[model samples]
Target: MKKRFVSMLCIIAFLFVSICGRIAYIVFSNDFTVSESYNSYVLNLETLYPVIYYYNLEKLTDNRDKYAAVLRPNERTLTDLHNLFPSSQINEITNELKAGYPLVKYVDESKIGNEKYIKTFRMSDYECVQSQLISKASSGLLSYVEPCGKREMRFHIDALGRMLRGDEGEEFEESLSNIKGIRLTLDKKVEEIAYSALSDMQNGCVVIMDVKTSSILTCISKPDKSYLNKAFSQYNVGSVFKIIVAACALENDIEFYYNCSGKTTVGDTEFSCQKNHNHGFENLSDALSNSCNCYFVNLAQKLGSKKLLATADKLGFNDDIKLYDEWSFKTANLPNKEELSSKGELSLFGFGQGKLTVSPLQMCYSLCTIGNMGVKNQVRLVYSSLDENANEDIVKYKASTRVLSEETSKELLNMLRNVVENGTGKSAEDSYHKSSGKTATAQTGRYILGTEILNTWFAGVYPSENPEYAIVVMKENGKSGNEDCAPIYREIVEKLNYL
Candidate 1:
């Protein structure tokens, strides 16, 4: 009996020792990880950045009135969760919550914990305005959570939150809080106007810029689902290229008069005007107003490839416009002299055809140069950044350069006004503001039902006398610029007049 009792005591002591060792291993081992559900974390909200469009009188402003927030799953039943998220999304939501993670960021917080609600990806109005920008500026920090749980979590994150989290790097580490929030030149009101105008289009874009500052006010791209911003994507520029041709003619002092007999031929290639309509006895101004293709072709021959391309280069052709770090406008392209060796190719190039392509943002800036009386300001989208203390770190851009003579720009502006007053761009006339612009119906070389598809465009400036705003509107697979795009420009301008 005494031997049995001693053996039992030894066995119990060994079991106690084993259990303590196992617990110690689980607590101290690097290879072991607690379930996220049981673990808590201090999400450094300061690490997550906020993006702003405007504040006070500053162009790129960040007051932090609006910040990034996440949707935290409250104490809701499983059935309520199912109703709040779709059947497909419910599982993901539940899994994320079970893992003690946020459901998603930048969600509408007012609707949280609503059991009767159906699943919708509803965001706050401010979030809707700056969602794209926030996604770019956050750099995945918004989704990252620390594995600490000493303090309660806050859903809203901004620069102030960063200050409270305390700096945890080298003592000399630069505090970029003044540049904390990504500041953009985009105007929310103007953005809404542009968006509403293109909402019905299958695929298109609208770009608006301040002529003097070259700040982008509104940029809207259709098919809202596309990751590509169509405003920065290149498309074949039609008659709008005429603006460049006209500049070349005026700057080089090239003058000519051409009688269009519906079509012109060069190197066995027959080029016809729109619907082959004959433009009789036209000079530079008349040709521009009528959008006469024959006149430009003749003009191109006179200027030749060297002079024409020189002017195009001066106007920022074959260049990528860098709006922000790593974010840029797709480079605009033009054929080199070797490619335009023949008169036929040159003729096509003259009328904004052949291998010429430009992004709508670039097109808008080209007009803005003219509106600024030949000064080309660097196109800007991001204005600056705000730090934790709401201090601003303004982004310096390249200085404006004179790309065209003031005299030539003034003449071109008048010609553009004539286009809106009595030419193809008549549909873009704004009653409240004197608008000037050029229209183009570019052939895409794609045939649908045996009809050549066209990319229509209308690029213009508002209050033409002293241009303040330059706007470009583009539509894919359209019938005519005046019919499809110019009207949209007019609507945008008229609405802007109220603002």
Candidate 2:
């Protein structure tokens, strides 16, 4: 009996020792504690998206560090769930929790009060970075986040107290560390000014660019729906193409004088000036200032298709102006020489009609080239990116190219100034600043109320003598360039001068 009792005592001692050893291992072993440490670290994890800033460093989108308030379902009761979420969402939340989701988002911060658990776990509101203009220009960099309901609980121990089966925790941490925001060349105040200036128009866009740097300062597009930046969208562009025609004439040393008879016939097609009003015996400068279709038609016949197409190509027509990844000014179309075989086709193409179409952005940049004294600087939207520590990574752009000679550009500038001073773009003249530009009234072939729809445009540079800024204003279904677009251009300029 004594030996049996001793054996029972030994067996009980061994069992106790085994239990203690298991507890100590769980409490102190590195392997066992790793998951605990990871879970604790991940519980405090917050997802951040990139924020977009304006040129002056003003926030264009929401704060990047903002996090979503989340609830750990394993730690909360049904009563807690009922108080936090809508009654309709209770069942869905319960199901998600039961389906191994360790946490769910609590979006209603108003309900989170003095309750210890709620207060301790509450996070910043999950308003992801978003802005209509920023999103469009940023190439989806400032896009919408996923819906709260669909957001996965990033990291937590399961109800059974086991690490959830995934490597997303480490991957998410790495990604978060690499996430960066962008600073754009855009100025919010200027953007707002431009937007307000076009308030009266149903459809149109405005683009202002710095001629020296090719940085877009203000870009506003009307009918601003579904993230569409209409400034980059193509339109007929009307007489704006005459700039290219004039450039061709100047570069080739082609000189001509034509007596305008109000209308000129080419092949079976006849072209007429504005209202068929004759401006007799016009030179290149007079024709451009007067925007004479007859004179340009005669000039186009003289220059032919190859020279026109070459000059247009050099000015970035029929090519995309890439600004950022997957974002660009829509390709401005210029028909090939073969396509302009007919005299009528070439004549129509001469004065910015037919198969020619350009975006407000494209036209603005073309003006910038002329304003920069024939140097075509690369167009840039994003200036730099900000890292987690607020370090800047400046964006690099392609080198500027000489698209026109200084002499030709100077001649064009003089002709454009004449248009503003004494011709079609007279409305664009400001008392404070001298401006130079061309006006265009394009035929869209779309009619409203039996009247043909027109797209009017005024593209030019401000403080004309030493050009600094290039601007383009476009209005759809308008009367004429001077009557519709130039006045708005002047209004924008007047406001900008004050700033």
Candidate 3:
């Protein structure tokens, strides 16, 4: 009887050892080790998607860091590890403990596609598990307890969720403490932008120019800062700088008016219109109106980069002009050596592709060159009022900088007028007001689907027969300038009784 009792005791001991070993194996694994040791813990992963997005978007827009305390893995690094460890034994063992097991803090879209999970979780549960793990790992039982990888895990989860949604706009999750009633002065309706538009705008500002009087009528900035007008913030202008290239063509006296023949090759590079579509031999006027990429590429080589840059600089491409709101604006820097290689690139550069970038205000000023008869006028925000014999009682900021010749401006205007009449900008034409304009559709980003997402734009002046007002509208990632941005401009004009 004693021998039998001892044997039973031994068997029970053996089973206990096996269970404990398996638990250790699952817990000590690299995956859980990294996730468990972080200072911050994610209780519920799915519910925090907005938190993740708001943090990143704010980071990008404000250029400030706030999430340093919460260490979470970025998305890409998590991907490689998951590929190595497909089956998670921890899931089963984790369920054996407590009431229920929470989903892992970090996930990938490729892994979590369309899968719905509960949003809320008790923070106490995460803290409890984390504390117990730390205790067990510290005793030399689980070696992987060091908290190095936890920093980026949360970030990864947020990024994955954002990628799945595909439309994370720029607005941040408003803090309850910061809520204040918005004051509206104007009675006109204010339309809320799509998530994508707001996302693109981020913490940026917008400036709308009326070229006729060198005036900036609309200036708006996000986040409600007291100073630093972002409307003039110079980013990569993309292909909008093409107007400068057109100016170069006219100024050089290169009379290749009817030379805009379909696609042309310069050096080893090929140049074509926006889509390599054939734009039969047309006059210089038609070439400017259509924004032919190939024509400008050939023209850039003839005029050369040095002369082009010089002309652009003279036309307020690199000057500090006050854009109202008590702030100054500067144009983006031009490219150098290594940039002027392939002829196709030069062509794109001429048409505002490649290294060329500018502010919307700068683009307006460049377009204004044509409307003001070749004089690139300095821009102002406030139109001044004078007392008696124009003596300065109240100082208005209205001032114009002459940057071009009258004849040259006239020639450019004639070309642009033809554009609205019969070119890519026909959508911008209003029967009520004769208009001359140019349309731009810039391609940005690497995503295959985003290639179709063009940054549409329309820059022009009204009453083409005798210009009075010049307006410019730029829509980021819109379908087309003719369809998206021009319609907005048209609507605004109609409301103003100007159309």
Q: What C-alpha lDDT do the candidate models reach, one value each?
A: 0.73, 0.76, 0.50
lDDT of 2 by residue, 93-129 (tens): 7777675434536555466653434322434232322
> How many residue pairs clash in all the candidates, one count each?
10, 0, 16
Q: State the displacement of the C-alpha of residue 389, model 2, in Å, after optimal TM-score superposition.
A: 3.3
TM-score of each: 0.76, 0.78, 0.53
| Candidate 3 local lDDT, 1-499, one digit each (tens) | 9999999999999999999987676445323322222233233221111010011121111122211111123233233333322358424423432232123433332443222221211211111111211122222111222211111122111211211111111112222322111111111121122112323343434344455656555444443322333345544454446667777767777677546556777767666676666777866676777777776777777777778877888777777875333335365666764676555556667777666666666777676666777655556532332222433223344356666667677777777778777877777676565666777777654345545545567777655645655566666556666775565555444443422
Model 2, total clashes:
0
Estimate the Cα RMSD of every predicted model relative to the unseen true structure: 8.4, 6.1, 17.7
Tell me how far candidate 3 lies from the true structure as C-alpha RMSD in angstroms: 17.7
Best by TM-score: 2
Off by over 4 Å in 3: 1-207, 220-230, 235-240, 258-261, 323-326, 341-345, 382-401, 448-453, 497-499
Arrange candidates by lDDT, highest first: which order?
A: 2, 1, 3
Name the weakest run of 10 consecutive residues (lDDT summed) in model 2: 144-153
TM-score, predicted candidate 1 vs. hidden true structure: 0.76
The TM-score between candidate 3 and the true structure equals: 0.53
